[model samples]
Target chain A: GESVGLHLPTLSVQEGDNSIINCAYSNSASDYFIWYKQESGKGPQFIIDIRSNMDKRQGQRVTVLLNKTVKHLSLQIAATQPGDSAVYFCAVHNSNSGYALNFGKGTSLLVTP
Target chain B: DVKVTQSSRYLVKRTGEKVFLECVQDMDHENMFWYRQDPGLGLRLIYFSYDVKMKEKGDIPEGYSVSREKKERFSLILESASTNQTSMYLCASSLFSGAGELFFGEGSRLTVL
Candidate 1:
């Protein structure tokens, strides 16, 4: 399978270690944010989301933190496994673009045993 | 499970050829989007539709058009394919609310010669 993010930033973590991925947006008015995971040869899969009103949201083994003050978002994964290896993308909803979601250049996460 | 189905997984066309990419969502989402993904560039929106028979241009809508004749279906059309248009095309659907998370298809990889 062809890799998704060949030239984007990369993070390598050993199995069982926690991983954090960060994203920054230029729009402070962006009220919605989402995290997506895309494996090789597949489209992005929704992992989690957070609204501007909330600072943090957690899912099973995954946590999404939103810092509206700085227009930053981060995804934290606990107990990382090899299956978690993929390209992760952060999407922001831009009201100026008629509420279309704009995606960031993905971060390639490689979980090694 | 919510499924967004893309009609073609891979396609090859020559310059000046007409190309059509079909997307269907089983979740009956109100908003559907077409985006092209390239290495290091993330995903760029081509077009989107929030309702049947209605369309909106995204940040990068040139050379692309879309149709949403039915609630569950959205189509991306390239009037005349170009080599620069060759990329991994992704289709996604979300609820009407601007804050809703997007669900994406497996994607259609198109190559224009």
Candidate 2:
């Protein structure tokens, strides 16, 4: 079955270090992608989003990069902090009009202070 | 700031029991969705509503049903709960279509015994 997957199931980083999370999607028709962070006992929170038309989009301390040719996506976070520890998920928006997102298995990010 | 709130943070149900999860959004979003997240499988969509009284079955809606009596409220129902139905359920809302990042509530953790 077609699916989206994260390269790593868990990541550990030190405070003040940069962190990178990768995702690979199977559907070529996916036109939009989003990154979400889920803390303990909380729902997924929106971090950043990017459309297929553009290659990269930057937020406060995060950046989303998309590679349509490889069907890959990545999220880069600058200055890892304790508050950044959470499960990060990558979601893709289908090209069809159903307005649903396909999500990947989350990657647990642990920031060590 | 937009907020999505769930009625419960934790719920416990016995086998064959019916369960309901409620979600409300302060923002007048046209699109509301329900999802269940599990380890390895990630977040699977249960159901979604684009408007009041309109619902669509998502990827995994076999043992579940949904209701959207009002534009700001979406509810997920488990016709008969089972052990395998235990998971963290999340509710999210967004604007019409897939134009914006989704706003999510604190998830409801369901434990089916």
Candidate 3:
């Protein structure tokens, strides 16, 4: 089945270092993509988003890059901090599916001090 | 600020019991969604409502049903709860059924024994 999936399930990074998470999507028609951060016992929070028309989008400390040719997506977080420890998920919006999002399994990011 | 509120943070139910999870959004969004979060499974959409009284089944909607009688509220129902139905339920709302971020509630953790 065509779905969004993450390459790694867990990632550990040192505080002050940068962290990167990768995702692969199978659908070619998806036009929008979003990244969410989820803390323990809480709902997923919107981190950043990018559209297929643009290759990259930057937020406060995060950046999302999309490669339509290979159907790959990546999230880069700069200066990782202890508070940045959480699960990150990449979601793709299927316009044909009436605004539903296809989410990746998620990558657990742990920033060690 | 947009706020999505779930009725319960945790619930315990016996097998074969009927379960109901309620969600309400204050933003008067036109789209609402219900998803189940499990370890290694990410967010699996159970159902979604685009407008009042309009419902659509998601990928894993076999054991779930939804009700959206009003614009601000959406409900998820488990006809016969089973042990396998134990999971964290998340409710989300969006302004429209297009490319945008979803505002999610805290979540409801259900345990069926």
Q: Which candidate comes out best when scored by lDDT?
A: 3
- Which stretches in model 2 have alpha-carbon errors above 4 Å? none
Model 1: DockQ vs. true structure: 0.70
Q: Pick the candidate with the highest DockQ.
A: 3
lDDT scores of the candidates, listed in order: 0.88, 0.91, 0.94
Whichever of 2 and 3 has more lDDT, that candidate is: 3
Docking class of 2: medium
Candidate 3 chain B worst ten-residue window by lDDT: B95-104
Chain A TM-score of model 3 comes to: 0.96
Q: How accurate is candidate 3 locally (lDDT)?
A: 0.94
Candidate 2 lDDT at B110 equals: 95
Which residues of candidate 1, in runs, are more than 4 Å off? A1-8
Model 1, span B1-113: residue lDDT tens: 88999999999999999999999999978999999999988998888888999998876899998889999999999999999999999999988556778889999999999
Binned by DockQ into CAPRI classes (incorrect, acceptable, medium, high), candidate 3 is high
- lDDT per residue as tens, model 2, B1-113: 99999999999999999999999999899999999999889999889899999999888999999999999999999999999999999999998586568888999999999
- Model 3 lDDT tens row, A1-113: 35899999999999999999999998899889999999999999999999999999999999999999999999999999999999999999876766688889999999999
Q: Give lDDT tens digits, candidate 2, residues A1-113.
A: 34899999999999999999999999888888999999888889889999989999999999999999999999999999899999999998876636788889999999998
